[model samples]
Target: MNIKYNLVVLAAFCCTAIGSAQDIVTQEQAVKLALENNYGIKIAKQAVEVAENNTSVLNSGYLPTLTGAAGATYNLDNTEAEFSNGAPPTSLKGAESNRYNASVNLNYTIFDGLGRQYNYKSLKEQYQLSELQARETIENTVLQLFSVYYSVAQLTENLDALQETLEVSKDRLVRAQYQFDYGQNTKLGVLNAEVDINNDSINIISSYQELKNAKRDLNVVLGNALNPEFAVSTAIDFKLQFQKDDLFEKAKTHNVALLQTEKNIAISELDIKSNKSGFLPTIGLSGTYGWNKNNNNGASFVSVSTNTGLSGGLNLSWNLFDGGSTIIKVRNAKVNLETQKLQKENILIGIQRDFENAWEDFENKLKIFNIQQQNIITSQNNFERTQENFKIGQVNSIEFRQAQLNLLNAELSRNQAKYQAKLAELQLLQLSGELLNVDF
Candidate 1:
């Protein structure tokens, strides 16, 4: 019984650990999850659906529509009556009446001043534009995901650097104590070493807090529960391969906002045409088939009759005058179309400038990364020389500790530069509309 209880407790502990393990979603997995579950994206998707439905409704004007109707009614009346059987007769009577009718109506627009055509075309353009807007939302979500994921990883790397520094400081303190006991080092040296260790300890604590904050930020972006114990992959390589010229060219063609704006301008033009359609005549074909029934019950007798018939006709409607409302609407539509055209041009210019700026930022970050790589090498060598000198009693502990701190700073700078370069590359890719295609 004791052994069984121990086994059960061990199993429970293992199960709890597994359940509490941090979910490390990959970039692709994160994107897929967000597309499926992100509230903003879901709302955008619903908007797209509404646009599609509108398109369908607009298209329906071109198709024949059949409608059906049926109805029945009855009435009851009460009154006093008198009758004379001589040359004239006068009577007031209680009566009941009933009627039934049914009809099937059909309408086909043979011609509608071309309004339906223009409206349908405009709706199609609008639908496409909405889809493009949804794509833009997706791109933005992915950018946020990338930023959050890399931020968490960057903070984790900083923690590792701090921990390593802490360990090195502790080792130096131990050596300083032994050397002082053997009369090879001064008490001041040992005290300086101890102070450096204490500083590193503080740094480690600060780094831990930063890592926790980074994790929290990531969870918020991912729409996950805010728990700081999650783990993420920290090993990242920042080598970027891209051609600036190619990216710039792709941005002009593939950017979602630019494409969507162009579609908007097209739809605006169609809107102008549709609003002007009122001045033209509309032509249609209509048909109806129905059943009519009547029942009569009076003092004379009772009778019932039913009839069925079919009817068809051509229709033409023209609005010759409408208080100048049609003219005003046409002018307003024209103005709107012109405004949309100007807006589209402005958006194009903005996108071009954005692409150029992102490229510049990318190049600058790459240069910094290259410089920092050399700085790290130089700092590491200098720190090693200082360590040797301190061990041989040629230098004080202050010099050694400063050298160590310098190395740590150099490492941190390099890490920052590396990730900054990656971020800059990502920005450039996004501006160029290449992020969706990139395999990384």
Candidate 2:
């Protein structure tokens, strides 16, 4: 009965341990989680919202401003006054007075040399620029996530390969021991086998550490708790079908960075137009309605008075001269407009270069991947044959170890090539502004 109870406890502990392990996370899930939780993306979204809010007509000065105010004041004083022309003198003690006023005023810019119109257009363009910037931020974050996710996958594969190598080394050690016990192999052979096993063990430990570090990095990108343990589904295959010319065309039109620079150029051109408006006159209209009342005490001829009135007017303002500052501003705006044009051109050039480089990298990596795929099969066959020969004393321990190492190295190379190809593929998609839209 006591033994049964201990077994139940042990089983429960094992179940709990299994249940506590982290769930497997896929690349899509990682991207979704990061888009939802990443602080940078959230901030970027807020900035986009701010720009949207600023694009309103009210913010662009297209609406009239109206204000209303009312106030009253009371005064208590001892007063003495003399009229020089009439030769009269008057004095009052503890005199009390009150005044009240209320007004409503409205003002609107009737005309400003089309400055307001250009300003509104610029604001709309700025909002678009901010949206593109936000998308750029999201794209960058997704790229980082992909890089880390695949890195974890690569390391995990390498670790598995190393574990297999360690197992092979252990098998070699066992065979060497058996042969030595049977007087068919020297003690030196057994020692060498043990050393190989130890070396493989060391490598396995190092690979595990690297895998852990990579997973930690992935967790950071996922905006999860650091150092959390989780498995990632490996994505080792990628297909590229777009031509360079087509991709370049898409990049020129769809790339977020390039689109943003183009918007900037548009805004700069609008600024030049707006600054040039300074040479023209501004027209405005304003109106006000008000009531005023005053009360006087102690020896005043008029005891109380009230007045109400309505007023309206149009006003024009022209900056005829200001130390040549308007001319300077217009010149500067033109220069800035030119600078923006140059920047747009530079961005276009950069996008072309990036697309070309990423395409070449993908092509090269795909070739390497194909070669490694063949190499892995050869190495695997060689290791198996070497293992069979070693078991029958036809192959020495060193040759068996070499075969094992060759298989391990080949597998590692294959894994690296696959991941590098995927990375290049992702880079190409990113440059073409298609990564965010594609299903990973």
Candidate 3:
């Protein structure tokens, strides 16, 4: 009785392990996991944080600097003094001295041709640019996630179709073997059927391997362990409702890349102003308060002394000449500004081109999807008719095999077209900066 109980326990454990090894991941869950755990998105978020931290008022030189310091020293030495008027020399052994000092200083830049103001503005814009760049990274990651997820779905469909074809081939093989055993069919027919069965088996294996690879890639995108067995939801559906003109207009302003370029132009203009500020005199205020003490141990004259004082001043500085480097910098900054403008134009052109290409692809895939959808139905009917005919010995194996292949190819094509259409639609939305808000 105990042995039987142990066996039952072992069986239950095995079942639980098998069940826990397989996971069912929906598309929405995959996207959420990627957003939470993707390494690239995390790095981009950190970069934005760094930019925010660097945009402080102190970094822009708007705040004064205050510093305080103190120190003390002790010394011991032999001292000798020579009197010029008297022809005698005097010496003392083990002379000792001590000294102390402390100070607090403040410095503030009063004026620098509005350079600080421009610098502050540029820093703010830099922070904004970093944020846009992070958003771009997120969008790209999400798009890639969607693509990989759909690819796995497509491969899964292919694997299913191949399995179905393998079953059909196996059935044909069995029929051929039975006929051969009864001396009703040629041995050549049995051999040919065996070859078809083997071929179908090989195709199924290959399709399953491809599906595994696709799932591995999806795991990589989701930042999950590579070896886990999981299944993705098989629903692939999306819609595009915006016109081309509307998409173009939205992309012009909302696209992260273009917005980043605009920020760069503004930053470059500020850079020019900052460099020009070097040509103007700068004004500042500085103040210091200090105390000092000195002691000569057991000395008759000036045994101890202490002093304290407070001092303040206004300072002015001007870079009268710098071998023309400042002016050259200003010129280069202006050139950079122009380059940024040209870059913005180039990005706009590229964005328009991408949007047009994606639009075209989306439309083309929709058409292909429709064609393949009808093809699958026709192929299925043909395959069924040919299969029945083969069973009745009214059609040859070659004709029936061809119909089977047609049905398999049609199903695979339809699956691919459906996913491809979804991908193209996603890409179009991505280019228009609407992908961030898209529902999975």
Which candidate wins on lDDT? 3
Return the TM-score for each candidate structure: 0.85, 0.90, 0.89
Report lDDT (Cα) of residue 64, candidate 1.
93
> After superposing candidate 2, which stretches have Cα over 4 Å from the reference?
1-22, 75-89, 225-227
Tens digits of per-residue lDDT for model 1 on 202-248?
Answer: 66556666766777766766667434566676555653466777777
Write the candidate numbers in order of decreasing lDDT: 3, 2, 1
Local distance difference test, per candidate? Answer: 0.76, 0.83, 0.84
The C-alpha RMSD of each candidate to the native structure, in angstroms, is 6.8, 5.4, 6.2
List ranges where model 1 is wrong by over 4 Å.
Answer: 1-26, 57-59, 77-92, 225-230, 234-242, 299-302
lDDT of 2: 0.83
In terms of lDDT, model 1 sits at 0.76
Candidate 2: which pairs clash? none
**Candidate 3 Cα outliers beyond 4 Å, as residue runs:** 1-21, 73-94, 225-227, 297-300
| lDDT measured at residue 253 in model 3 versus the true structure, 0 to 100 | 85
Highest-scoring model, TM-score = 2
